[model samples]
Target: MSFIPVNEPLLNGNEKKYLAECIDTGWISSEGPFIQRFEKEFAESVGRKYAIAVSNGTAALDAAVEALGLAPGDEVILPTFTIISCISQIVRAGLVPVLVDSDPVTWNMDVTQVEAKISPRTKAIMAVHIYGLPIDMAPLLDIARRYGLKVIEDAAEMHGQTYHGRPCGSFGDISIFSFYPNKHITTGEGGMIVTNDDHLASECRSLRNLCFQPHKRFVHERLGWNLRMTNLQAALGVAQLERLPEFVQRKRQMGALYQSGLAGVSGLQLPLASTSYAENIYWVFGVILDASVPFDAEEAMRRLGKMGIGTRPFFWSMHEQPVFQKMGLFCGERHPVSENMSRRGFYVPSGLGLTQEQQETVIDAVRTIMDS
Candidate 1:
């Protein structure tokens, strides 16, 4: 059998048709009809009043932080188990990132612990929906409301998942999403920021376009990077956004298959099937080695790689990151849950394009390894 890759985007939809239109119309640059259309449609999908498209997810986070006008020394609490992008933008804006532990079940930020971390310096709570599960937003939002803290939701891994009846991106002051090939939808590489605040929307638009002055095209009042997404990407995004519901259903189905097939497998802790807040979309069908397991994810991944199966390790805790340690940030801070996950957690092939036969092959390979 050929090697099963970790992620393969399903581009059978209108990707090609949109790309062709972009090329034919010569509207391939950042400013084009598709860009506006994508921003508007995406905002509507997330129930936001405004959406700003950017080059990638990191840029989206950066723009949101900048648009919030957070002064230096302001603190933003976020999950230590999330990607570096969540903390990087805050750090770059001269803001402090207050790290929180992940919930053992949901693998999302422990919303209960958020209140203890909030200080007078805390200006915002950056809630990152991990894997396919949203952070329990009701409590998070309540805490934010009580404390008057801004909420920045990073829904990068959660495209279709919802909390209660509301969408994942709809709960924040500013929410962001990524359209990388591995995400629920693909624009090859793109991202978006959504918000209801008109002033923030305008600030993000300016930040995305090099902070260009409205009256003077060549002048800028404040410094900003050219983190604009191209019309080519927006065209593809528009097509993808139309099929988001279908994509979400497919992801849930894939997650169900993995959960059923991998059930009763010893020494493996599967991703949560469902929480009280929302069902898991199984972004990549992750698994963690139990303490009884003899090796960490690195060894398991190597063994699987040799068996022609692809896998990816979980994110390392930000508190343990050497870069952060050197900067005297997160000093003496420790999150045991996040640390353990980094060592033992990994996700197998669970992309939208995965086939049944391939999935069975993956299950058999994993069983064979564990049984040995």
Candidate 2:
């Protein structure tokens, strides 16, 4: 009986070969050929005109937010059920964060609630694709268009997903991706910002490099962070990008396996496999404990841990975060759907490298616990 982790990166492709090439050519830093190559190919893949590689997903968000040149009191509408990086960057850029609740079915930002959250000061909408599902982007785009607001698509968990046949990352004014080990692709730690606007692309490039002046290096006109991605990471990213189609197919198969194996299990609500917008890539095989169930995700996770099976809780709603509460932000805000999911939802092993046998073992363990 071996422990099964919640997520693992599949690096069977040219990961090692690319790293070796970087080492052999002594092009391991951010200024190497692979950086440009990765950026170019990734932009093309997502149907964007330009892409800028950055140190990590957080950096990508920071640079993108900064590029917007948002005013101190400008408002940015985002989902309550998203990673803190999404909200933190907005706050850091001197913008106010306004939150919308999640759709009970899709587990994504409920577009219906978005209109009520908008105000005269609203400047942008950050559409975060949750888990493996793309948010219903068409209406969100419509809202943005009507209000003259910018859209920032966080496609970190939705690499290969699409909406109405259009790519997830292609919908935003500026889109971002994370190459964390748990993501569909891995550069160990890397990120990219993609946009169709040439000026914004150039701005992102400058922001990623400590705002270095084109002719006079180090004499910066604007303050920026050194958030450049290394060539070694870009090399790995290029290889991963090449295999994205195959990786997406494999993920779908894995999701199907979990659905079949865990179907009919009592007190468990499985992740949605597909919706009208797009099929779930099943980033992780998440499940929510039914309200009827006596235990919460924490207790269920504890039980799974005792059985040597790894589990992870879902993202806590931004409205409920202690830091935000302390800052007097999102005061009295209640996103019921997100709050419920945060407490009851937990994902089991759903890595791209997960074998059929290991998946079955996880299913069995889950079924056993539910039955008890």
Candidate 3:
């Protein structure tokens, strides 16, 4: 039996054809037609007016922060339960990251906590759509509106999720996506920032290209970084984007199967879908181990890996991480829920191309571990 990995990219003839054309035309580098086409298509699909492709998700965050014109002493609020890359960019952009605990049920930023943390220095709120589940945006938006703050969405894991009939990325002032190899769509390693503001969009493009040559070459402007994505990546992304709807559908099917398979299990708690959203891509199918259960999430993962079923630990809370502690970011504040979830939570295999038998194998392995 082969190991069922967490994610797998599905490609078709279009990707190969475009990649070959790029190679043949000697346009495989940064400047190419595919890159422009991809930016336009991706922006439209996500319901944004503009999209700027970059090297990786982290760079996308940097672009958003820089484009917003965040100043020193500015504070950006984000959930403690998120990838380190989300918080790291705020620090890199010379801003303070105000970390808050997440909602225990949704595993997303707790919107209720936002009001208490609102200070005069608060400039933006970095709302993340965790594990492909869209956050409740109404409250977040209300808070932002009340305080005159911006919203930058970290939508790396969520490609096809919506909130209150609106797309996740479109709710924020600026939103970002990652095309890492394991994501729903892959362009090897790439990212994009989407925004409706023309000025911000142009600023992001300039920031991605070292803030030089808005039109003429060798023209110096504000300092920036070389974070542009290659034409080959965009070629692959265009192919992936064409198949995204099917990919999202298949993920939903597999996720439903996982929920049904573990339905009556005594020692596990399954993730629930949001009532306000119609679609969720299930980027990762996660479960929480009941304390009454005989085994912990880590030990079960180890046992399942031995059974040819690969799994991963949930995101470690940023507040508990040593790097944040060294930087004095939420050092004393204990996010008990986020910390505990990090220990008890683990996600099963959920790839776009995973077969029914492969999913059954994972279900059997997990059941066996619990049954034993």
Candidate 4:
């Protein structure tokens, strides 16, 4: 049997047609019809006023931070249980990162803990929808409104997720999505930043292209980087955008299969679905091993690989990493819940195109390993 992957991108015939057209027209560069169509279509899909395509998710984060007009030493609050890009962009923008602990069940940033971290130096909050789950954003948004702080939603792993009937991207002052090959959708290696604020959108568009002015050649308005997405990538994105609704539905079905299959397993706790008027596009069907479980995430992954089942551990806690420790960034910061989760959490095979037979094989392998 072949090794089952944790996540895989599904490319249909529509994507191939668009790619061929882009290649034939020799319009595979930055500016083209596909780029415009993708931005417009994607923004409309997520209920955002504007969406700017970029090179990758990290670049999207950098653009969001730059648009905030944050001064040096201003802090951006975010969960410690997240990828490096979340914190890297904050540091890149010359802002401090106030890392917070996550709730054990939801594996999301604790809203109760966010208020204490806000100070005069606090500028914004970067809420990352960890794994495939949407963070509790209603209370977070209320806090943001009360404190007059910005919210940057890292919706890279959560393309089709929503919160309280509103989409995840719409909740933040600015939100970003990744179209990497393994995400909910793919455009090879592309990203997007969504915003309703016209001024911020204008700034983001300018900054992505070296802040070029229309009137003058070689004119630069501000110091910026080359973060533009290619027309070819956008071509693929446009095709994928049209099929998002169906893809989200398939993803949910896969999640249900995993829950039903693994419900009786003693050592593993499946992800809990949010019923707060929001739907999640289970990007990765993650499971948390109980403390009494015989193995940690790494050991379980090794055993699963032996059974031809591919698995991946959760993101390493940013505050506990060596790079952060050497920088004296969070030497005394303690997030025991997220720290422990990093060791025990792992995701099984859950892709958009997963079949029932494939799911059964994975579930049987996990049961066999745990039952031993």
Q: What is candidate 1's lDDT per residue for 187-300, written digit by digit as tens? A: 889999999999999999999888888799887788998999999999999888889999899898888878898899999999999988688887778999999998899999
User: What lDDT would candidate 3 get against the real structure?
Assistant: 0.87
| Count of clashes in candidate 4 | 0
Taking all chains together, each candidate's TM-score versus the true structure is 0.99, 0.99, 0.96, 0.97
Residues 107-165, model 2: lDDT tens digits: 99999999888999999999999898889988889999999999998999888888988
Model 1 score (lDDT): 0.91
Which should have the higher TM-score, number 1 or number 3? 1
Candidate number with the higher lDDT (1 or 3): 1
Pairs of colliding residues, candidate 1: none
Per lDDT, the best of the predicted structures is 2
- Model 4 TM: 0.97
**Which 10-residue span in candidate 4 carries the lowest summed lDDT?**
272-281
Ranking by lDDT: 2, 1, 4, 3
Worst 10 residues of 2 by lDDT: 87-96
Q: RMSD to the native, candidate 3?
A: 1.5
Clashes of 1: 0
RMSD of each: 0.9, 0.8, 1.5, 1.2
Q: Residue 336 in model 1: shift from native, Å? A: 0.4
